[model samples]
Target: MAELLSNSFPATPTGTRFWAVDKILLTYLAFTTILILGWWSRVEDAGMLFAAHVVGVALVVFEVKRPNRTTWIFRNWYALPFVASCYKEMALLIPAVRQTDADQWLADLDFRLWSVHPTVWLERVQTPALTEFLQIVYTLFVPAVLLIPLLIWRKRRPEEFQYYAFLIALGYLASYVGYLIVPARGPRFLLRNLQHVPLQGMWLFQIMQSTLDRLESAHYDCFPSGHTELTIIAWWASRAISKRLFRVYFTYTPLIIFATVYLRYHYTVDVMAGILLAAILIWSAPALYRKLSREA
Candidate 1:
């Protein structure tokens, strides 16, 4: 059974198409489409979606034609996020299993941690130069999303990539569970006591807010930040590949994460919890995977 499940989704041989979909490629195409369509109106986001599809198709074609499995793997880092998303959703649903008071968890934390601004100093450094640098650093997380696949392609390290992906999924799942078990309406949603600070990026904030508003469940799970978890997993995975350049690049992910609070999106406690969550996930991932692998 373990061997069968392990082979269920072999992340190799670009020529071998699983279910005629090329599992990783199909996931990328599906997620990109879902994000674009779910964000803007169908017609409005169509052009960008089409172009993205074209590029994705081209990349998959190149990967599939490439003689090596390594080239095929990195071309599809987009698949990892989908896996994480599933776990996050699972986390949200977990509280219901025990009939716990999720709202109380959210409210209590609001009074305990987010009430004071520990890193208020960061907001003061919001000069054009600093903001520009932070913005660059913040955007670095985007590329980290692609790093795992690149590592897989470069080193043919699919096992490591799979392990990293599993860790990310579990981290997100734990975070969402934290959300349910300790639902906090993030700092942005609870601005009554907070000092009003400019986020600078109104458009970006609105887009993100709208998405959260549209979510069907667990709106108050703002503690143990998802962005932080994602960045942490990416950074750790980057380090695993021994790519010093990307390891350094991923190191900056936490700074941008701090910027999330100064940008007035998350609270100081949320950021701290996120960092802590990353540590826990990093520590637990290998052991957990080993257990799961055995059970498989």
Candidate 2:
């Protein structure tokens, strides 16, 4: 069984060879290195910046040394944090790329398409119950990413797990690149005129609210909504895994989509972009994975 699994998703070769995860990490590392080097003089806290690169290199080394364990870690745990840290570091490294908010264009696009700003209009129907429900749904985004691959792993579906993990990483990679190119803080932060109401619910809602407030620095992650894209990826993965799980995610996806705009975390345009991005990634993921998985 182990040999079969190893043959299916080839283990990283001994010595300094790159696996799919390494390719992803190296791509990010190269992008960050260029950014850091280009702006080296302007970069504040150079020590911290270099330290992050050191840690990233160390992780690559560690993974290379322990391919089997590292494969498990990469599939189950490391992917999300790796993406998040790279994104955060990118935002920190080049904070001034987008000086102005891109909300007007997104708002205008929404009005042109639907004749109303979705967030502002959604506010009219906001109730404590609905808000709580949406918050609860939104909170599922993180767990969905983590749990879907875990389910695949538990089922001994290594190839499927690898594909799903690759898709998740690809979704974030695409979204993070979008953040770098188009840095727009969403409705709540950018558009002050949209009568914002605080989220209210039980303990889960309160936890979500507190977490969002604390981690609100990820404001630039608005365009091509990561939440929506990730939810779609999770849903797609679950569809392959089981009918029951697929139905559950499919049922809640619309709520997740609506929650993005209703909760004021994304524009309709952002959500649309996220959906489009997910479609593209889903179509291309298998081919891309095969190419990346090929031995050099």
Candidate 3:
């Protein structure tokens, strides 16, 4: 009877438990937790959801090669707050967008943030061709950043996995910070008011309306530009994966970054500040990760 039952159940590895967390699994779990939490928080509308789908598939592939359960559960505790923070941010953004202009709020808070002088100096930052171009370029950052890990994984560069993962996590974290610090109305609103230019970019206009809807749909929360922040970080992180290819993309990174403004999706100030924010994260994170890894 025992043998029958044993046979009836799928056989387990000779001595291993039915589920055991491994490092890869832990990382996978962490990725899923972050993505879900980020999306559920509604901080950036569909951004987190998109990330979850993309990253979730990659994690599944990783787990298929090397299964682990224990590591996932053990590390689950560490991801709790970050997930909570993601949710907290979403809640704040919705109401914050409605209740007040995040930009003015920051101004009132005495932070005195400044975007780079270059974005504001430009005269045609809101042209239709430029706006669409900017949106398309900014959107490419996700694929660009994710491609690195996919390549490394395909090549079985396990040693570099953590580094890639760290970049991914830190890049996202910096974006979250930018959202909190600068929440200002983007280029379209700014242009319509400050420059009195007619908004001609239909796609940009629609996205802007959708974004505003998201903010007012729940609250108000636009300040630091996630589009700018994440795009820069992804562009920089591309270098870590391949200098040869990085050189190619690096040239366009600025143009793409600039598109955020020309399209009226981000304030020139937001892009400038976001660049600085990405630089700070990219510069400091490697050493910080090494230190934390050693301590761990």
Candidate 4:
């Protein structure tokens, strides 16, 4: 099984030739070039932006020299920070592109669809147990993204692992573009008139709230909830790997979807949009990966 798994995704040619590095280089260069050329005046911390690009380049070089390390770093650690920096830079550029929030429109859509704001409604029956459980499920987003791919890697299923990674990256990229298109601070920020029910639970809620407070400035990423989209993508990727893993994630899916809105981190429409985005990526990622692989 291990031999078959290893053979499924043939290793890229070694020495001076990198498979995934080329695409990573092009994407990093394109995004950075646009930042430097188009949004040069608006960029708040040029030094950090430059440093991010430098880090991307350095990672690529390191991956080229140590091809065996490519799966772990490029597929996992490297992209996290790179994608995060891109998100931060895009946030800086959003005002220059548009100075508007679509929260009202989204809220209205939610009302028409469900007759009440889902989060606000859910709060009516919120219990300490439910809140704690939802928060615990929500926190699984990070591990879901990392662990499933790690499992595939451990099983020597490089092709499956790469496919999962590609799906995640594609989903995030789509959601980031959505963030820029319709920047929103979600229901928590927009629906100030509504009575807010502060999430109450055990130590988990405290930890979650503290983390949220630290990232309060990251308000623009709320339109299509990255948490919802990425978690669903992770679930889909797990299904491709093993039935048992898929069942484990499938149980958490509803909790995650509800938590996104129940916690007021995402509007109801954002969760719907996230589901749609996950579907699109799952359907299209294989072909996208195939084309990129062929090119590489």
Candidate 5:
């Protein structure tokens, strides 16, 4: 999977203008720089962040630099890993600048909405059989998110894949920005002691859950569930490529969504925010994608 994702950025013919991916990345880099600068004192490793931005910009230049005429590479696939790097960095970035998390607010909201702590409430129904199934589903979030798009790239037009890439990338990168604004440790950390029953799955469940825990940082990645956002985005975007693929996304996306809350990785509010985020991107981002593709 790493090898496949590493090679997602195949070199493309250098065009004479920036494509949607390049401009989107430039915009994202500029946004991060401003975020760092705005909270410069809080960010202890501001220099490293600025250095990341510099390298990000250099990648753009390496692809598009031209002495006489501007040459913009249209390799939007690179955005996949470029944005993945952005997500990975948030582990360090979120805690450096943000003093506290917003888990309480989210937890309180869930209580107000439903009059109970969602994860604690979920314990009544928690069983090893169900836990195992949901844990496996929860672990599949990345694979499900990546597979639909890769399928599109293999089966659909380049333009279609690029647009989908922009949306998927935007979904994740935007969620990271959401984390910057609102850091949360989710129900797992915040509500660990309240629950009496541990969600011990039968087989692959515990291993998968433990592995994701080891792999994930940015412990406060709960306010807006990237799992929920990108899964829906992948499902919706797949409609353009193939119904079979769309159906695949449709079936598993909700399961992925359920796993977010069921596995204690997100608050109900986080899931709602993710759904809203996905809706906004689906409704409004197509115009932005088209504009960026045409202008840059």
Candidate 6:
């Protein structure tokens, strides 16, 4: 499976056909659409969001049914916007799925790990310089996540691109499911009072921090940190793409994972779970991808 996803095998541009990545996207959108319909009464502007899902579904269907009408610009990149919508839809629907956020329970698990809060203990080493560096590192996860796939696509490796995109969708959608099962507000919100030290970044920290807060202020997205899981998988998958890509992410991935806790966005357990989830996906996604691709 690893060798199959390697650069050794590049997928020729088959005629416009729905691939596994498209299936993954459609499945998540459809799944969330169903959930939203059942729980529409709970979400604000639920009807409008429901209509958006219909439009999302229609678009994907149209893209699939009429490949002559699209190009890689639409076909390749269409998943990203829907992925964002998945986050938005999942945020709206998760509360309807589960009543309470698991902040306290997740925090307790963190406390059991060390008898002291991991984020609080890390405060001893925090400095403005380190904080700024890590905040920057943390923000890099999104772009870093995009780079490897972009590299693969630019290399014109359709097979590798599709599989990597599928694996990424699996990683992210799985994290959303984890949020539903054990939704959490993360250490930053859950343990804000326990945290004695402030995360003072050197420059543009507050502005950067507030911007992120506004962008990601969705409900209970903590357990099994998507930042950790996605970044780890992105770095790991980079190994099969480009040597330089592999090398950079090797350095960047761990720092981003650490930033999740140090910057107080996730509990220690969440980071651990992210590592575990990444490991699980890297191990299992290949066979799943193969099966789904063949079946498609």
Find the candidate with the highest lDDT and give its number. 6
Query: Residue by residue across 1-296, what tens digits does model 5's lDDT show?
Result: 45544444344455657767677778888987887888877776788888988987986776666522223123546777787778767776788778888988888899999998888888888988899998888888888877766776555356777778788877888898899899998989888988788888887887888788788854678869998888888788778767888888888888888888888999999999999999999999989888887752
Model 3 clash count equals 24
**Which candidate model has the greater lDDT, 5 or 6?**
6
Where model 6 places Cα greater than 4 Å from the true spot, the runs are 1-17
Best candidate (score: TM-score): 6
TM-score versus the correct structure, for each prediction = 0.57, 0.86, 0.57, 0.84, 0.89, 0.91
Q: Which ten residues in a row have the lowest lDDT in candidate 2?
A: 4-13
Q: Provide the clashing-pair count of each candidate structure.
A: 4, 0, 24, 0, 2, 0
Candidate 1 lDDT tens digits, 15-124: 43332223433554565455445444423435654575667666656665664645543433544554444443333333433334343344345457655443343556
lDDT of each: 0.55, 0.75, 0.51, 0.71, 0.80, 0.81
Model 5 TM-score (2 dp):
0.89
Candidate 1's error at 289, in angstroms? 1.2
Least accurate 10 contiguous residues by lDDT in model 6: 1-10
- What are the per-residue Cα lDDT tens digits for candidate 4 across 185-258? 78877775684677788668879767865754555887788888888888877876789989988888778888
TM-score of model number 1: 0.57
Which 10-residue span in candidate 1 carries the lowest summed lDDT? 16-25
Indicate the TM-score of model 3.
Answer: 0.57
